[model samples]
Every structure is written in C-alpha cells, then in structure tokens.
Target: MAQADVEVVEDMNVEGGPEAGEAVQVLRRVFGYEAFRGSQQEIIEHVIGGGDAVVLMPTGGGKSLCYQIPALVRGGVGVVVSPLIALMQDQVDALRALGVRAGFLNSTQDIEERRLVEAEFLAGELDLLYLAPERLRVEQTLSLLDRGKISLFAIDEAHCVAQWGHDFRPDYLALSMLHERWPEVPRIALTATATEATHTEITTRLRMAEARHFVASFDRPNIQYRIAAKNEPKRQLLELLREEHAGDAGIIYCLSRASVEKTAQFLVENGIAAVPYHAGLDPRTRAEHQARFLREDGLVVVATIAFGMGIDKPDVRFVAHLDLPKSVEGYYQETGRAGRDGQPSTAWLAYGLQDVVQQRKLIDGSEGDDAHRRRLSAHLDAMLALCETVECRRVRLLAYFGQESGACGNCDTCLAPPQTWDATVPAQKLLSTVVRLQRERGQKFGAGQIIDILLGKKTAKVIQFDHDALSVFGIGADLREAEWRGVVRQLLAQGLLAVEGDYGTLVLTEASGGVLRGDRQVPMRREPEKAARAARAKAKRAPVDLPEEALPVFEALRDWRGRTAKEQGVPAYVIFHDATLREIAVLRPASLDGLGGINGVGENKLAKYGQPILEVLAGRGTTDGGDAAGAGSGSDHAPPEPPDDIEEPPDDIDW
Candidate 1:
C-alpha cells in the first residue's frame, strides 16, 4: 500500500543465494505492472536465490509473474510444466508480445517447431520454456537438459498432483523426475485450488519436500453464489441468460453431451449467443467453439465439464449450471471462472433430482471398489448439502475446502432467503406412489408417471399400474405435478429418494428412513412449478434489443480507451474492462468522480485522466470524455455513482 509498508513486506524475504533487483525491473518493464502481488516478491527472491517453493494464489493473483520475472533475471531458462495447451499458448503469446523469450512444446507443434524451440533452448536465448508434463519424462526431453540450463522448474496447476483435484493429470506424477535429474534446479509449484491435503500432496509428489509454502488469501469477494431448486432448469437458465448474463461473457455447464447440445441450441433459439462444447465433439469443432467464445465479447458457451480447464478469458460475467456437478470441488473450480477480473459477477445453478440420480449412477457404474464408491458418494453428498443449505453458500463452499468465511450476505441465501415449509405429507405421498407403481407394474415409474398417479391421472402407464388403489393415491391432488416433482427432486438431493439407474426403478436408500417414517418433515417451497417458473421469468428483464440511448456513450468511451491505451502504451483492459465500459455507457457518469466510482477507476487514475474524461463527460472538445485541453485541478473532484435508467443506446455507432 504505502512505500514503507511495501519495503517491510519485501524485507522479510529469504534467499537461496542470488540478487533480485534486475528481476523486479524485468517485471515492471515487460508487464507494465508496478510491483509483484503479495508474497510474490519474496517468492521470486527465494526461487532465484535457489530454494523450491509452492505458491497458492487465487485466480488473477498473478502467479505466473512470480516465476517469469525470476526466469528472466536468473542465469538459465525457466522450464514451466503446464497441463492445459490453451493456457500455455495464451501465456507464451502474451510473453512473446512483451518481448520475452518464451515458447512451448505441445501436440500442436510440428517436429521442426519443437526442434527450433529446443535449439533456442540450447543457445540459452529463451527465458522460459513451457512443457506438458506428459512429454517432460521422455528421452528427448532429458537430452535437452545436457544442452540447456534450467534455472527453475515451475509446475503450474500443482494441485493436479492430488487425486481429489478437479483437473488431476496422470502426467503430473512424472514431475519427481525433475527432482531426480536436476536436484540443483529449484521447483515452484502453483495452483489456484488446494485444500490442506492438496497442498501437502503437491509438494510430496514433486519431491519439493522442503519447499517454502506461500499461501495467499483465498478471498474472491467479487463473485456471488446463488442456487435454486431444480424447477424447470431450462427455463431458469434462460431467465439467467436474459437477466444478468444477457450479451455478457459467461459459461453454462451441463452434465451430458445431449444436454450440452440441447442447452446450446435452446439458448441460441432464445436469441443468446451460445454454443455447445464437449469431449464428444470433433476437436476442430470444439476448438472453433472455444476460440469464438474467447475472441468474441458477449458469447456464452454451454458445455460438458470437459471445457474450461485452463481457459484464460478474463471477463466472464457469470457461470450457471443446468445440472449438478460431480463434486463440490468441480463446482468451485468451474464457478470460480466468474468475476476473475475483480468485478462483481454471479454463479447461479439450477439443479434437480434426476441430476443427482444420474451422478450416482455414473459413479456406481465406474470400476471403482466399495471404498472408492463411498468416497465419490461423500463428495456428492457434500455438494448436495451445499445445494440444500439455506445458509450462505460461499461460507459452506470455502469451509469444505478448509477455509473459513463469515456470513457474506452476498449469496442467494443471504439475499431473498429460503423459507422452508413442512413437507411430511408430500413426502409420504411421493414414496407411496413410487412403491405402488413398482409393485403393480413390476417396475418403478419415472417422475412424470408417479406424479400422475399421485394426482389421480389415468395415463396409460398409471392406469396399467392401477396405482390409485394405493393408500397414498390422490393424496397429493391439491399439489401440482411439478410441485410434487420438486418435492421428489429435493428428497433425492437429501438422499431420501434413490434411483436404481440400471433398472430405472425408484429404490429408496436406507437414508430415506426418516422421510418414510414421517420423522423428517421435508422442507420445500410450496409454490407450484409453473407459477415458480413464471415468477422467475418475470423477475428477469428482457434485454434491450438495442439500448440505443447509451450507444453514443459506449462508442465515446471505447474511443477514449483506445486513445488512452495508445498514448499510455497499455492494453485497453489496463485502462478499463468491457464490463466497466458498459457501466460507463449505461450511467454516462457526468463527473470524473462518478466515472471512478463505476468500479475500475481509482484515485491515482483520476489525477492522470480525470479532466480529459470529465471534458468528454461534459460533451466538450472533439469527443466528450475526450479533451483537447490538458487536465485541470477542477477535474480532480468527482461525484457519486450515476443512477439507473431504462435508457437506449444511440443509433449512430462507432466500432
């Protein structure tokens, strides 16, 4: 914060045996970033000084710089082992643009390309070389070592060393070779997610046994968590798209290939810019979809869990799931993708009973032993508990990962708040219907048929089963079928209603004991499914086909950003992100202070561009928020946040 405090923070550094002033300068020059982010400066000094380290920084915490700066300042090339090809390319390209010597070896590279990279490596002309762990153990890789010097072996995504990690890679196991072959080379392992176990596992696996651990704060204050019951998940997701996510950068995750395609198509038909991606798709098609989502603004990509392992897109506004994730860690990592740029964003999920059933079925179908199955079930149970919680989701999520957070009042539970109603009767009716249908037809009926029987419907299946003869028949006639479905889904989430996937039968697990015995009064929303969906639909405002009154304002801001970026020689984002731009456009901040209050602007930036921006805001000079006149003292004073409006973008555009 202050100069003296910064010095104090850096003063606590440890060293293996090296100087680091040149490294700091390299950092400032190439990245235009003034200083290293927390523990980074010290971590760099430690690595360059010659000890291995493990860094646990949040996403967007600038972990890459901790290694990159030291690599350039030190005597030899930095060998960075990474898992994601996309992440590697993005990092390398960004480094190369900054005039740094960085290259990577991936499946995408031709043999000559690999040879050339290795040649540069031997010549000692490369500052850093990215390696996929899978290729790091081969003879060719070992041969490169004789010709090239390794200053440090940096392992990114170090959490992959843990079996519980969402992005676990088998290749990560080979990292022990780095320690075996080059015991002299310092290793730095970095990850955004690592509980106590994961952290311990990384160091143990890499044999960086004595690594100085630097664990930064795990606070992502900008992201909000919201979970809704799986009531018409499709429509709920659509509501999310139109509301906060309309024309915004975001990702929606589903559990299946069919759901992925269907969701993407549904979103596209509903007028959102969306596409589906999964392992089942052709690689080229998947790559194209990913590229399009990355390069373009306002694109929403719906995909299976396979997507976005190491995507570097910075402005994702929200992350929504149409189905339940396999584990809480999976959900956390995926949802963490939102608000990465330190702006407020949302993580919304609409889940239901079938998702839980499907997830359990998949886990059971796997070749794992009973112990392994129990492990999977434990993770799933935790996730379902999170979904069922009326308490703060963020607190529970962080708590699961061994971090503590107080009530944040930022999640849905802290906002509207859930009010649970006694559902004893509904629960008994649901169980009885399942039992009656299974007994009569010699098989369990799906949710629809069960709901029909409960409501006295004479559908072909229900009539054939003669389920109305059951004691619980017509007992739930007052509740709409969808409401009953919601009840059933919630029961499944609680592990009270279990499905036999192979036979498609409703087999109550032992966990269902309380619900059947009326010992558990299931808490449920009393609202009918159709009415609930309608309420959600109404809550989300339709996107302004073109909010035209704000059009000129947005164009002017973009122009200002470009001109400022050119003069300052920084990327447009270093000035302001698209979200900030959109807000500026929408609000049309009448004063420099008002502009600063819009999120990205701060006091220091105000002094530099305040007047020019204010002049533009006042509609003066060539463009308003633009100024031919130099900045003045008067422009230093700013106002409050601009009020909201149902305005439109201008017809004439500049883009």
Candidate 2:
C-alpha cells in the first residue's frame, strides 16, 4: 500500500481499518494490557481521530500509552518532543523491547547514528521518533520533519512550558510552533503536575486552548503521605530508612548541592548504598550515577530538584524530603516519583521552623522583580498551609490541582489526627516579644534569642543583650522551647509574623495587629508525641501484601529479571516492572498462553521470556536464599562501586 493511501485509511476508519479495534490490538500485542485506564481509551481515540488534547494525569497513570497507542494506530512516525535527553536511550530501548521500531535524535548521537536514524525516519520505517525540544531551533531539523510522513505530536512533561511552573524549561517556550507549522497533525500535551493556573498557562503557551482537556484525579492511594517536625533531620531520615525502607530503592531530595552530598555520604556511612546527583556534577558523572540508580536495586539517590523529572524507574519504594519544597506542585511532582508500579510506598518529609525561615530568606534574596517575588511567596504560602493543616494531606494536595477529594484515611493527618489547640494566647505572647524588642530596645532578633527571652533563659546571647530584664521575659515559661517555636512557626504561616534580613529576624506583618488586639484567634496543630510517632514508624515497616508461599516465587522471578536486565544492559524494570513480576508469582502461570494474559506480558515479551518465567516459577532457575523481608523488592546483588576520584568535566561537555 502507498504511504498516502495507508494514512488516509487509518485516519478515516477506526472500525474498518486494516483491522478493527487497532488501538486495543496494539495495546495487547505490543504493550500488553487488557483494558485502557481512566481516560486513556478516550484520549487515544480522540488523538487517533486527528484531534488535539491536553492531558493532566498523575505520574505512573499511563500517560505514555495515551500517545503510544495512538501513534501505533495512526499512520506515520509519531514525533515526541521530550526534554530529557539523557533518558531517551532507555525509552527507545524499552520500546524496541516491545518490538516497536523507535529511535531518538539528540546531541548525544554521533554523525553516523544521527544519519542512520534520519534515514530510517525518512524511509517511514520508524514507528516513533523522539526529539529534544531545543532541536526544533535547527533549520535542518525542521526541514527533516517536513520530508518525513508525520504522525501526531506528543509533548511529554508539558508543564515545563508554563513560565511560572516549578520545572520550567526555556527551550519549551518555542513548542507552540509545532501547532502553527503542522496545522493538520494532531498534538497531545501530557503532564503529571499542574495547578489550575498552570493548566491555563500550559494551554495558552502551547496554543492548545481549543483542544479537549482531560484531567484525571491526582491521588496515589498506594503512597502514604507523612510530614513531621524536623528534629535532627539527618538522624530522623536514617531511622526511617533503617526501620521501614531498608534495602529498598528510594530517592532522598535535598534543597542544595551541598545537602545532596552530605545526605548521600551520611547514608553510605550508615551502611546504605547511595549516590549523589545535582547539576554541579560533571555530565558523565551524573549520567553514570543515574545509570546505577536505574540498573541496580536497593540503591538510594540523594539529589536536588534537578533529578527525577523524566525518571521511569517503577520500583522506587520511597521519596524523602529533608528540606521543604518551594511549592505544592514541586512537592507533588517529587513525591509522585515513588511507587510508580502501584505498590505501597511512603512519601515522608521532615519539616521545621528553619525550613520556613530559609525559604523566606531565599525569596528575599532572589533576583526576580516584585511581581515574580509575589508569585514565589504565593507558592511557598500554599506549601506551608499543607504542612500546618490538621486535615487530610491527600485532600489538600488534590484540591490544589482543582480536584476535590474526601479524606484518604492514609495520610499522616488522617491516620493520627492531630489536636488543634487555641494558640491565640501563645501567638500574642510571641508577637509581643517581637514588638518589645523593636520598640523598646530598637533591635531585631532571630527566633532563638526571642525564644530564650520568652522562656526567661539567661543564655549567653540573652545576657549579652540584657534580654532577661525585659517586662515579658518570663511570661512564656509555661510553654517549652519546642512549643514556643511551634507557636512562632504557626504565626509565620498565618502571615502575622515574617522573617527579614539574612539572619531571618522576626518581624510583624500587617495581620499581626488583629492578633495583638485580641481580635483574631490562632489555631495551631500539636505535633505528634514521641510515642505516637514511634507507633506510626513501626506500622510503616509492615511486610508487603503477599501470601507466604508466593514470597519465594517472587524473589526467584526478580532474580531472573535482574540477570536478564544485566545481560541486556538495560534497567531491570525495562524487562518487566515489579508489579508485573508480583502478579506472575502470585498466579504461577504454567503455560505460555496463561503468561501472555498477565498485565505486562506483550506478544514480543510472551514469545521471548514466557518460558523462562515459567522455569523460574517451577524452581528450575536459581533463587537467592536470603530472607525476602530483609532484601525488600530490589535485587540481592549489589551494583559496581563508583570511582572515588570522579571530577567535574570541562565546560564544553554537553550534560
């Protein structure tokens, strides 16, 4: 059949193409799923009918399939505009494993590689082609696309196009040209995180305002969200990992490069395998660290926000934040990285008064204009509200995206409801201290000195300033230092108190007048006591939901998968996700036909690995003898050791 005629038939007739139900057929024959999830089937049909769409789904919600199935059902090569150059190879490898002819063009490719992919694309042999968004600037690339038989455009991580978003990429600003140039070709923009404002921004910036919008619920019920007061956070993180997530694949996000290094080193010293990632590292070192995290099991990656945007690893068991995120969108995006395989996981964060002070200081010192600073403060304010709320975290989180949901019963607030006390008196006392210092002494002080004076403790700094002699010195003695700090934090969150200067000195906002005049009530969330916290920690360490006899079979299948992944030099999940393996072990499929019916076992995979999977299930393959509880879901084998003297490369190297 000629290419034009084939394209016309596929585009016009969904029921009577070469085969009926082509999208479903591709889903089963290639990606291996029985039914489409959520709005996936509707989105696929719309795109296959040559219509544009804006898709808002949570991470691991199968956004890829929304575009992939359409690309397979429609004619020509589907051009994917992706920002993750480093991960393109893994994506293509995964597609090729499913027997799809996939390729990518990026700066990482050599002249020969680029020519080969270009030739394949021009010949209409490539089913899908991935391109970095920046490549569209090159005339050669635009001309190249014009010569090829083009399918729909798939824009992944579409939130980056929003100028005010947490993960904005300047290269994405030019993406609207895709619609302008290819007026007839359909386009689909997909993102895992976006607020209502960001959603509108994406639509406006991408010129997709007329496209149908599909917004899915942003709840990941399998992930238990927990945020606690940051008491010695490094030690707290260590305890959490030791008790609940030992030997599990996880990501620990820090706010700075220095913190990333310290956290990784801390984990390594505590006998946990870990690697550090940040933009400051050389490109090669970053790539190698990313490769290790993807290929090995039970490896922890300590990183800044630079990591985890396009990471496809499905078995990450936890995501911990030692520092507070700047915004709710960022927090959701980072935490969404965990439990991609739909297994139970933890999204733990250690927050404290210092986090708020530090974030405020950053905004003050930031280079943006007044309007930009206001935007930044708005983001921080929403995040603080989430941390301080006594209600369900999941409900608050989903509501930020304009999706209303009831209490999830799984978050920290719902599982152990916190006591909300009338802190109006404490709030007045703290604000009074600030006023006395500013009016009488003509001075400003940080939270430490203020707390010392409130508690009437004659510490060195207090005595140095003669703060012990103040009129309100001992009035707050009824509250402990921690309780006073909580009052201060709550006041800051309420905007009655503000942090100023590099030292984060306390100052009063316009809202402080009502509190001082007894016209406003301040309610504060009481932090969970030590015993309650310990109980929750213990509960999180419970075993995975699997039958006793199936544990060994699961371990054996993981062993086989690890070995196969190593043989192919791809990530273990690329062969088959842990969720898929868990089901296989539970069902113990005895025949090839039965194995093919599993969720992730596509035709190519069933024909290739089905027999070996059965062998592992039947006890023919070698199994690791260690207790499955100790090893968790990752492989028992350790990855290779990284070099000790890794250094930053020259400036010319492309990262």
Candidate 3:
C-alpha cells in the first residue's frame, strides 16, 4: 500500500482537534519546524487520520515527530508507552521545552507528582503522556486511560516487544492489552533497531500487522566504523581517547562490570573525567554517575552494555568498545548513541580471536535448547564474519539487517581496504595437522599446540605426544607463529575450524574437508602492517573545524550552557544541544527575535534564555552584561545548520 500524503482534507471535522492542515502550523509555531523529512509528513498524517504504523527509522531521524505532531493535531493526549523511565523523562523534558504540555507516569514519580500529571491528563491539558509499560499494566492506570480522551498510542523502542531482541522488555508483553481494550485507537510502534525477524515479531506481538511499515535507511553515515584487532586493548582505548576524542563526552563499553570499573579508573588516572556504571553498582552510585555523564561536559562513562539503552545524550562524540558486541543489531544500537546531534562521530571496536572464543563459549554455556543455541551460533558467526570481512563494514552491517548498501567509503574497510592472499596451501597444512593430531593421538589440540607443532616447536606436550615424529610437524616452518595464528583465526571465521571443550581445542568442521582435499581454495586477509594500520586509523578521524573568530564565542556559549544546566540540574544539552550552541556561535544572533528565529530556539526557550544567549554572543564572555543592541533581537535571520553531518531536526522529542 502507498503512503498517504499530508493533504488538506476538505470538510473533514476532527471533532475537538485541529484539522489536518494544522499539523504544519503546530510543527512551526510550537516546535519551530516548517517541513518534514522522509516519510514523517505522511506518517504524521496517517496517524492523525486514525491509522496505525510501524516505523523503523534510524536514531536522529525525526522518529518522534511522526508521533508528536499527530498527537498535537489530534483531539486527545498521546500516550507513549516507553520501556525505561529515563527515556520517558528525556522525551518529556524535550517536549516540554518545546512548549508542549507533556508528562510521564512512571515509578520515579511520587504520588503527588503522579496525581498532578493524572489530573492534567484527565483535564485534556496534555499533548503527550509518556508511560512506562509497567505503569501501563496497572489497573488504575488502565482505568485512568478509560476516563480520559486519548489521541493515539505510540510504542517507542518497539523492538523490545520481541522476546529475542537485545533489549527485550517483559512488561512489553502486556502492552497488547492496550489494543485489546482500546480497539478503536490508532497505534504506532517505533524503534531505531530491528531486523526482519524482530520486525515481524513486533507487529505480530503488538497486533499491528496491518500497520504501515515505514523503514528508513539504517545507515548512520556520520559514524565512522572501525574494528581493529585487540592488541593491548586498554592502551589502544587510551590512545583512542587521547588522540581522537580528547575532552569529548563518550561511552566506552566493556564486557564485564569489573572491566567497566577498571577502565573508568584507568581513564580517570589518565586525566579523563570518567565514571563507572553497571548493574552491579549501588543504585544511587549508578544514578549519580549516569546523571553526571549526562549533566557534565566531556565526561566518559565506562560501562557494560547495560549503560546506554535509553541514553538521550545527542553529542556523545564517540562510542568505543573494548570488547566485541554480541550481534550486529546490538552493535548498531550501541553505536547509534553517538553523533546523534548528527555531527561526525566514531564507532570503534577492538576485536580478536579471544572474542571469538569467548562468544562461542557464552553461546554454548547459555541455558537454551539446540534451536536456540543454533540461532545464537548463527548470530555469532555473522558477527565474526563482519569483524573479519575485508568488505565495507557498513555494507555488511546493513546487509545483515536485510538492506543492500553500496560501499560506504566511511568504514575501515572502505577507507583502508585489507589485502587478501590465497591461503589454500597454508589452510590445507593447518587442517591436515588437525586431522593428523586427531588421527594419531585420537585427540584435538588447541591453536597454540597446533601452531606449535606446525612451527616445529618441541614443547613438552608435543614431545609427550611424539608430535615431532609426525610428517606435518615441520611443514609450516616457513610461516611465522603470528601468520599461522592468523590462518587459524580466519579458518575459524570461515567455519572450517571450530574450538571445542574448555581447553579451546581446535577441531575440523565439515567445511575443512574441501580445503584438505583441494576441492576449494582459501583466500585470507593479510593483516595490515602496523604503520599502515595506524596511518589509516589516523586518517579516519573526523575533522572538526570552526572559524578562528567563532571559537571563543562557541566556548563562551558552552560555558554559559554548562552553568545554566548546572543551576537547573539537567544535562547541558537539555538546555541547548552543542549543535544549537555551534549555530549560535556562527550566527552570533543580535537579539531575542534573532535567537527565536533559530531552528531549535522556540518561543518558550527564547523567552527563558534569550538575554543570556545574546550576552554571550555580544562578546560578553559568559558575563551577565552586554549592550542589548549588539546582543539583542534585531532580524529574523535563519541561522544556517552546523555542518553537513550535524543535521537539525525540524521538531522536538529527542527520539
């Protein structure tokens, strides 16, 4: 079915709400945007016209406006079912900043606060109401909804409804009841991450199979994707922080809580303002650290995967992973946190053979049946293939999600394509050795032992097994141990080798037979020279340039934003994102009206923060005094956007 255009429906009465044409007006006056991007205009029109939708837009792609605008144009309050309280709070705060009456019902709210929000909802004063799925499951909450007029139901993070999704929410399983009870209400489910299976599961579970599916491109071109072999990962991460992302707010994801603590400490010791966050930490400490990460500038949060699910920090300059992510979907979502202001950012990872082994063991040890294990294995295999692939990482990443994309020229492979060589001989030798070891000793050995035998090392185990007597013992002497290790890693990635048992013994898979019999040729990626790799990594750093004159004013605005956010006890971006500040710096708006003309500065924000912004722009250096004419409203100049990558959203609701 084709998407409907946002046309003026003549003679159509929306009962108590604004007509269809009023969406654009509300978009401009309230949220300060004059148009929509991609299918946002159509999606908003459909939902407002009482239709359902399943939107798979990327993060920072104006997914929120698809629901928010319709909610405003509709007759009643838009109830958004969110999985996390922090996410709800961020969305609500951003909506309120736009002068929209939005509130959230969650466990974090006290009785009085909840009551006030409920009263507002019943009075039909709220444009949007964000609710945690857990709260929505309550009888009283459902009863309250029955008592009020609802515009539409929006399910954010809709992928959570899939039991197999990385961020599955048990509470979301109860959300189907919303449709069962309110059969007349239109519903829209939205997520930034979902594969075909997850997508189907979402629509099936939510009973929105008939909902129009709007899937935008998953490519985040601004985020540079680089995967390097793990070599002293901590030192590499430190170098990444120092040389690439100095004084930038980012997240460094570790695989374990202990690693998170250690990495945070290491960063702090190295002069980075860093904090540790994980499920193991006390709630207060975690909350405090998360708050600081959000509230302060250039603070790094070293954490496990648990840290970044609902993070609304738009200017997270980078997302570095000290360990490999479990799947492409997980990696995509985790990295999607960065560069959300649309500025250039990086998604860097340190992957190695150990990651392969650890992930394999994790899958094997997981409590699941064979089918589940097989699915996990497939996911791991795909992840490994991506890490080891010489093709564009972005291309492969998107392909994994069922989207065919051309070479991005942004990922590590496209920037520095890896060299490949025919490794049929070496592969045959390695597989023959494994077969020899199994046949001669009726046992499989680890890669170390196999490489030892191949490199003609006379170790005790080799001697004990009398491996020196074998014909293949010295066959691989021409290749160095590291080269041989590469061969093994590649073979494992190719499914020609498998690591079994706690000892990580290498065993031949069925695919090994073709190579051993010379029926197939093996092509392997040659590890880039260290100097070349370093040079490529250096070249991949995104350039950030500001005019020399605008530098001081930018810093001044940042200082003012920091101070204001501190006083308000909110993230600096909550006051104004760095992109907005950059725009202000470049434009140097003269007055309140000039500031009001800015894309992100709505009437409420202009009135609340106009004078201070003007003072900063008038060379006041964050002080309270400046000539109002030099710093004040003069013209309705529309400030140009920050950069090509730093896209400005037309509206609010930081989804």
Candidate 4:
C-alpha cells in the first residue's frame, strides 16, 4: 500500500516543543482528553522527564497516550519501533487526525515515500516516526535516525521480545541497541498481555531492567468470557452471530487454514458478510481481506493466529475461537482484540474432547527437545485449566498474569456455576483399563478404542483383541459415552492422563500413579448445560444505554462518520469512536465549541470535522442508516447493568 496522505498542521510542530509541565495541556488540546486515566499521566511524565519505563496496560487502557503525549511535550520526533507494518498507516492516520505530525518508514512505502518521511524526520517536522523493528537492521535506517533530532524510543508490543512469548519476533532482539546507541533518550516499552515470566524476559532482553515498570490490572470486565463444549461449532458460531452479534464486526479464529476457509464460507453461505484470512492466502489477498475488515462495518474475518496482532480497530464486538488456544497469553491477546471500545463484548470459545486430544498429539509429535515440549505442555496446561475451571474465568486469567481479582459476575462460571463431582472411581477404572491393555495385552490404543473397552462395546476390534474379557471391561458403563469423554478430557487437563503417539493413545503420567493407587481423589467439573441454555436465552448482543431519542442521532452520526471515513480512505474510528459518538448524541452538542468539548474531538478534528458533526447532530446531514444501531439497540429489554468491579472511565475520556 502507498503512504496515506496526511495534511500536517504546521503550527503544532513549532520549535522548542511544549514543556514537560504542559503534558496535560497537550493532552487536552491535541488529544482532546481532559484528564489522564489510570497511570497514563505517571507514565507520560516519567518519559517526558527522560526516564526509561515499561508499561503493561490493557488494550483500551490508552497506552498510546503514554508515549504520544510525552513525544509531543519532549519535542523532536518520537521514534516508535513497531512490529505492525500493516497497521502503521492506521496508527499514523489516527495521530494525524489528532493534529499530531506523524510519519512511518516501512517496507510498504516506496523509495519516494521513504525519502519524504526521512526528510520530514531530519527537518524535525514530524512529531512521531514509526518504524518496523526489522528496518533498524539497515545501516542507512540507523544512520537516518542518528541524523535526526530524537525525542524518545517507544517500543509497541514489547512482549514480542520474550523468546518464549506466543508472538515472538526475532527482529525484536535487536531493539536493545536503542538503549546502547541513544543512552540519553527516554524509552518506553508497552504491551497489552504478558506474564511475570514474559515481563522479566522483556526487561532482560530489552535492557530495561532498571526502568520504572507500570503493570496495570489485566482485567477487561467489559468482555463477557464464555467457553462452551464444542458441538457443531460452525453452527454454534452461526447462531452466536445471528442471534446476538448480527450486523456487528467480529473475528472468528480457527486452528488451520482449511478451517478458516470453511468457517468463512459457512458464515457467508448463511448470509453473513465474512472473509477468510490465513498464511495460505496470497499476500495481496490477505491485505485486501484485512483492509475490508478494517474499513467496512460488520465484516467478520475468519483467520488463524496469523491475524490480529496490532489491529487498532476499536469496535470489534466479539472474538470467537472455534479451536482451543495453546496458552492463556495467546488467548488473552486474541480476546483483548474485542471490547476495545470499553463496550460490552464477548470472548467466546468452543472447546471439546477433540481439542484436548488434538493439542496433546501436536505437542508429542512436535519437533522440539524435551525442554521445549515441556514448555509447550506447561502453556497448554494453563490454558486447559482456564477452560475447565469451575472458578471465574477472569480471575483465573488474571491470576496467570500474577494479579488478584475477585470472581467477575459476568463469566460463564459466575453466571451459572458448574457442579464438581468426585470422579476418583471413574478415573481409576479408566487408568486400570490402560494398564491392563499395556501389561497384559502388550498393546496401546487411542481414546476411541480405550473408551470402547471401558464401556464394553464389544466392537469388532475389541472382540478381535479379546478386550471384552478384560477385568476392567464394562466398569464405566454407568456413565454415558459423552460423560466418559469428559472424564478423560478432565483427567488429561489435570495431568493424571497423558496422550501419546500419532494416533493419540491414552497413557499414564507420573501423577497418575496416585490416582490409580487410591492415594488421590479426582474432582471434575460437570458441563455447564444450564449455563449454555441461559446464555442462549439471553441475547448476547450488547445494548445501547442511550435514551430512546438519542439512538437516532447516534445512528445518524455513525452514517456521517462512515461516509467521511470512506472519503478519507481511513478506518471509521480514525475519525471518532463509537463511545465519542454516543456521548455526542447524549449531550446533543449544538455548536463547534460544544462539539470541541467532547472527548476525542482534538483541535485538528474540531477544525476538520466539527461542522459536519454538528450538522449531523442538528438533523441536517442525517442519513437513513439506522442499521448502525442494530447491533446494540435492537432489543427491547433494558440494558444489563455494568459489572460493579470494572472501573468506568470519565465520559470525556477517549476510548
């Protein structure tokens, strides 16, 4: 893609930039926020005072402002090292819309574009300059940076520096050079998701061990966490979109390219606008699909893990996982892509027995030494624990990041608590069957055969092996096959059972001896069938809390935004977020000053789009696009109360 055209506001780029004490002034005038949120002010002031820092904030926690405001106050271009080459344009677009003179140098830019950006940087005409980490490897790029007046180095998505992180990038290992080369320049490394281990790894690898670390709470209470047993996942996903999130933008993640294609096709066949994205698609095709998903409304992108790394779109309503994620970090990062507007959204997953079996088989057959396999296994174990936990999902998730949080009353477990049963006898029976088959018959088999023998199915293979005559045979007949599968899955999750070989044969782990010897009791969660029913009964779509009269104004403003975004060739949120529009509708601002007082209406935006927004508010430029409110305002039922534990930001804060 060519560079996006941005009309730089010359007045904001004056020499001797705003003083450090003017941080709040810059925040209000440039970004249009009245106050700092959480630790944003602390982080911004620290950076502006020439102190290195590390920030671990949630997705919608306003991480950008931590560096953007500091860069604006500290003067000179803030050199940002980002891994998102595809998203740099959108980031710069958003900043330029705020009247911040931002530019980027990446592979997507032609030589002319790169030269122009480099010229702007050398002349001190840009406020922020974004570069992919890999670009710094080039001597010319380093020389270019050395020649420019530097402000600070901002590393976005710094978790990629962790060697064991889910989204590790080798290019990030070279980022430590920023510290060595520019010792006087302040630097800030930021990520939305990281464990204590990953955090330490980032600090160590990025040479920021002494930097003041700001670890915000990992909780995103606006997202309703739900995991259901997989039964016709495609159909379940279809029902979720149609019944709850119809006409809303979402992302559906699958485990394989073929699954991505199939799921996208399924949704499109069912009359939902959807597209497929995976590594298998051609680069241009992937780019087109991503652009459509970003620029258009209510478009679903079915992808593997290859997508959604630095996506800045703020209105994604749901993120559904058809297959299991390998780790809580991966799950958290993917799910964080939803509810970024601080609106009610969903992080839904469809997990089942096959998911467990498949993951184990992949690990066993993976090309790694024992230590690597062990690491992968540990990550999977944590994820499985989260999926199978009877406690609150959010609590378990936050616990993984070394944070403590109470049971969020919105997750699946809190809403409809699953029952736990003592499955010691059933576990013993299953392990005994595996033992008998291994010691007596000198044979091993997959779960299907093992389950058949346990239930005494007397299938042809069972009879051929004379398994029906075994002492353990028919011992588990009291439980149905589905229930037995659940037992095996739970056992695997609990590490009492292990899967081996290409066919996923059941085996005993070191911990299984205690269960087999009656030294330990196995407890398992009963599937939350009632929870599923209740969730289905209640509409999963988020409700708009605006007064009935304000709904139309909100829709009209959205219509105007969509058109303006199309004209500017940028994502709609680059113009203004839904949260900003909702407040505008509620307040019904009547003039430029009134509209300018709203959050997200920065000085540049106030001058550029203020009149148009006021026109829409006054019913002059209103269009017939009430579909904008369909996702959140269709239901007649009152909107659900916001969770008590979540801290609400001020009405004037930009999401």
Runs in model 1 lying further than 4 Å from the true structure: 1-24, 432-443, 518-655
Order by lDDT, highest first: 2, 4, 3, 1
* Model 4 TM-score on a 0 to 1 scale: 0.91
In candidate 3 the C-alpha lDDT for residue 158 amounts to: 92
lDDT of each: 0.68, 0.81, 0.76, 0.80
For residues 551-581, what per-residue lDDT tens digits would candidate 1 score against the true structure?
4555566677667755754334445544455
Candidate 4 segments exceeding 4 Å error: 1-20, 537-543, 620-655
lDDT by residue (156-190, candidate 4, tens digit) is 98999998789888999999999899899999999
| Global lDDT of model 3 | 0.76
Which 10-residue span in candidate 2 carries the lowest summed lDDT?
A: 643-652
Expressed as tens digits, the lDDT of each residue in 560-583 for candidate 2 is 887888898876666776657767
Of 1 and 3, the candidate ahead on lDDT is 3
Task: For model 2, name the residue pairs that clash.
Answer: none
TM-score of decoy 3 = 0.89
